[model samples]
Target: MAVSDQIVRWRYRLVPDHLLGEILTKRWVDNAIPVLILIVVAAVFGWLIPDFFSAAGISSLMRQWGEFTLIALALMIVMVAGGIDLSVGSTFALGNIVALTLITVAGWPVPAVIGATLACGALVGLVNGVLVGYLRLRAFLTTLVTLIIVRAIVDMMLLKYSVAIAAGFVDSDLWYYFGEGDVLGVPFSVATALVLALVAHLVLSRSRVGWHVLAVGGSRRSAHNVGIPVRRVICLTYVVSGTLAALSGVLFASRLGGAGADTGVGLEIAALTAAVLGGNSLGGGRGSAAKAIIGAIIVMIMVNGLVRIGVTRGGSSLLLGMVLLAAVAIDVRWLKNRHKFLSKVYVSPTYSELPEAPATSGSSPYALNDRLRPVEAIGLGQIDGPEDVILDEDDHIYVGNRTGDIVRFFAPDYTRQEVFVHVGGRPLGMAFAKDGALLVCIGGMGLYSIGRDRSIRKLTDETNRSWLSVIDDSRLRLADDLDIAPDGRVFFSEATVRYEMHEWPVDCLESRGNGRIICYDPNTGTTRTVIKNLLFPNGICMMHDGQSFLFAETWACRVSRYWFDGPKKGTVEVVIGDLPGYPDNINRASDGTYWLALVGVRTPSLDLALKMPGFRRRMARRIAPDEWLYPNINTGCVVRFDETGRIIETLWDFGGENHPMITSMREHKGHLYIGGILNNRVGRLKLDGMDPTWSGIDSYWRRT
Candidate 1:
């Protein structure tokens, strides 16, 4: 039992798991709550202020919100890229001053003046970008300094020159159109903001630059490792922020007919509040421009409503500050505990009662015989959790251990032991490629290969995650086992997308189809899913026929065959089902048969719990981890199966003193090599009548 299981059993009873899962699966509903809140607020205000819904009132609201909305959009971009800009308000004021001076005093054409104003704003943003991106300065401090510097410069310029537009331009048609004209019954300023918002939404959600921005914001180190230009993306975000702020300034100056020192004062806080309210994270990597627009509307409504209720300007400002503070606090807490919240609200699969175990009478076919006479203990007290074992051409034995190291034992006497390589994750299933490289499935890191020179490289770690997934399921969570086909293709199993490798038992309790099978081609660098939504698809091994493979679904207690060639290609069929134990690994035996390692034998209580989804859900919530009923992994047995899936011979360590939790067994050169996940040493058993010189590699690759 795990803590998650305990919480599930203790806390929930009345709410069915299926209904809870349905509610939690609707992620879009969470995002829509802000909009719903805004609607409710608007409805309340409209009732209170009879003129709130009138055309005149609506037009006034749009004009007042237009510039702030633009500024909010600017801040939203930086925030989405995992940064922030506090200088937007100052940049806005400066853009207005630049436009006023260039158009009225310099007597420049309106088009050139506008372009120059935007360029200057971009230049300011470029400086911020270089400092924050290239120099690695903190976004908050860098933007704060820029804000002070730009405001100071504007103050000095205002002291020396009057802030006024020329009389000729004040009455200009273009100026009037931007400032107060209407387009299709919508204010030109509002319409322009809407157009920019639409474009920003598309660029943020659909463009490469936007993707890079999000990636960097999500995890800067991961983005850099994946070859994304992290610094450049961060720099571009600041530049975009500056340009948008400048555009807002120009719009405000046009509407007011002149530039003022306080033209954009206090706008930065407003924009930030709006962006945060719209669901933008202060920590970055999540959010949208469209949401920012909605957030801006919410802020504007709050301000307008306060004024309508006869509150003082200062009092309204205080209320807005309080709102921003509350939103930030909620967002931070939510992000930190999102996983815990989701686990409680989702339905896990239910299991039926465990079927009766096969008869194990002394003369029965399923009877366990002690034919395995242990020869010697190899790597004793040196390795931890050698879940799987393999041998090379030179007869060197290799095992992946719990400490994330692949340990190798020298050939012949098999006494000398040394680490071959470190994979930085729990390494499980392994196979030798045709090119002699070692292909391994790392528990949490996905598929990887190590060359002869011991250099490790990642093959793939991503799959198409389901929309209903509560976490980012793109990365393989638990790549349990793998096998290679004759066509040089590597196939592997992701045990459970819903849980990490260590939490495998919890997955058993859920028994949901969260596992998947995937194939990767080394030559073309492509990885794709073969079969999805499986019940803990664990061990995988290519068939002797070379047209199909066998994989065990641990929770389902069944071995299934998947074909990739011949008539049965692209199909799956059950070879065996309703086993007495949960299977872990399947390996080829020397006598044209297969060895299956049962990590745990099923119990009646565990089986009964599986059948009752409601009871299991309650138990998962209420029971303490140490007190809850977990799968019986303490006792296990290995059985040999022929091509027809009929049991041939069974070997058992009933007391589990020699080999507890046998996860894998491989036959080679007249010997059976055994590996256990919880044992300290590897076990080797001698076969009575087999050639002593045979090797596993030679047996599999021999010419037809």
Candidate 2:
């Protein structure tokens, strides 16, 4: 190979699509970049400008940014978690006015004064939280109304006692020193901001509360359903925001030597601008307190620098607005479109190399015996929400359904069937254990092994981190297609913590991509994440060799292979891509091939959504869910794939013209039985010439 070709190969081996393997992708950079750029720009300009680099100039910058930084940090917490507070500015102004009135006129001690100010702010926050969180008021409107009411109250206070504060009755020194004081070359206000920023950063980055906040921001419904104290978290965040705004107000009053009408005026916009520019998203579930403060600092420096360059205050305001607009524009449009640039300049389309079709086509396929035909449709009327089916020694067919019920179909003719046992919640996938016990994947529960006596035993339900939030209905949303390896280790898919069975499509639009595949070792009885952040991971089937497993990503429309043995163990490979439909329950075929069920085909509209995130996210936020925006029941189908990742055959249901939506398909006694959530009766199909090796666990009954 040429030296240049070798260098190219080395680079590919070194990086090789960084997002594929890394557990944590760098999501925070989009928020951090602007602030970083601003800091660099400011430093360079200050170096060139004579007065701009001086200690006095730097102190001036600190004094200017003091109020904005404090408020922005508070805003960052709320915004990052997918929330907002409009009353921050009002609370800030009120804090200053209240603190001044208490210290100067009421003669309260400093501690009492500060406490009173914070309590007042907290009260406003509590009101906002109650309205937005519990009352289910729209966050934007609820906070807007609160902002008006709080501002009116502040104006009333000002009107009642403006003269007293301005005339120096408040002993200005107490407020003045705090705003201007310095220790060891650091401004007191700057030091205070730093301490608070550091503390907030640690709490958000290192604590579990922070994770809850992010989850809530990402999807409030998902968060609440999954057992996050959504109301409490929302309410408390507002209180924190109000308190921080109040702190900013107190400092501002001190710096100005008196509280005035202009105090904290338009501060809400400034804080929001800083939060957005710093990378705290208005949409939520993605933000940092550190970036928010940096954003505020950037805004302050821009305004201060423009003034230093002889721009009028009016011009500076225009320039700042322009700059903020530009930053937002860059984030929303440029960065997302950068993918187009990458495709054109550096590499070919990464999706072109995926497997296209099965090995056999356009030939008259061989047919199995006539016995398989009617048998395939025999269990149709008996199955409801049937996730998986297995056969036992007594010619009894055991089907695991998601509603925590197992249905039994008497074999030879799967005609006599009854609800075997009610396990509670949803059950997805199942496999026959070596001991004749049935291993089941119970959604909202965990892995379970059922005995012949109709009793269920929990194998493993939890993971290493007990601190990780597991909501009640989803204490464990383990789903479709589990397999027991040779060593008795069980592996399955979490599907999505963001959406339930009824709302699976919502997971696609949210695009937070929080699904993971997990493994449970029976010997150790421990569960670990085999692959994290696979987009809407749906199905998991242990490979034929048992050294690796094949799993499907429903949203990504692809199947991936994860290894558990050898040097390449734990590594994931995209075995197939650009699936024609959303892949569902995967099971090992009797022929050593894998049968994959395509629950729904990807329509043109949904496929186009992959390129437009903002549009999809907006729809998620705005569209009435009952609106039926995407194609549903009509396109349900199934596909068969071999071990080589080739699509061998396709089964089209079209929801049976009113009864499609197939989820799980188990080949039993040379027949195919299908079931899904909304289906009233399972679908059955006869394979005339299919291989006899297609018998699944359900075939054990035929042997018996």
The regions of model 2 sitting more than 4 angstroms off are 1-60, 73-107, 119-243, 253-269, 279-291, 323-371, 374-376, 384-387, 401-405, 410-428, 434-437, 441-480, 491-519, 526-704
Which candidate should be chosen as best, given lDDT against the real structure?
1
Show the lowest summed lDDT stretch of 10 residues, model 1: 9-18
lDDT of each: 0.83, 0.69
- lDDT tens digits, residue span 1-704, model 2: 45754564455345434232221223554654775777786886677677886887877888768677988987887776677887788888998899888877787877788889989988888898888877878888888898899888888998987777777555546556777887677877888888888888888878899888888888999999999999888888888888888888878767765766777767787677777788776778777777887788777876677777888977876766776687667656644565543322221111111233232224512111122123234455555666555555464667766556888877666677888788886777778876778888777677888887878899877655424433222245545467777777888887765445566665665444557777888787677777775677877777766698888887677888988987789798888776766787787666667778767666666555544444553454455556524634445666777866776766665335633566677765555666666564555666656664445544322332
Each prediction's RMSD to truth = 6.6, 9.9
Candidate 1 TM-score, C-alpha based: 0.75
- Top model by TM-score, which number? 1
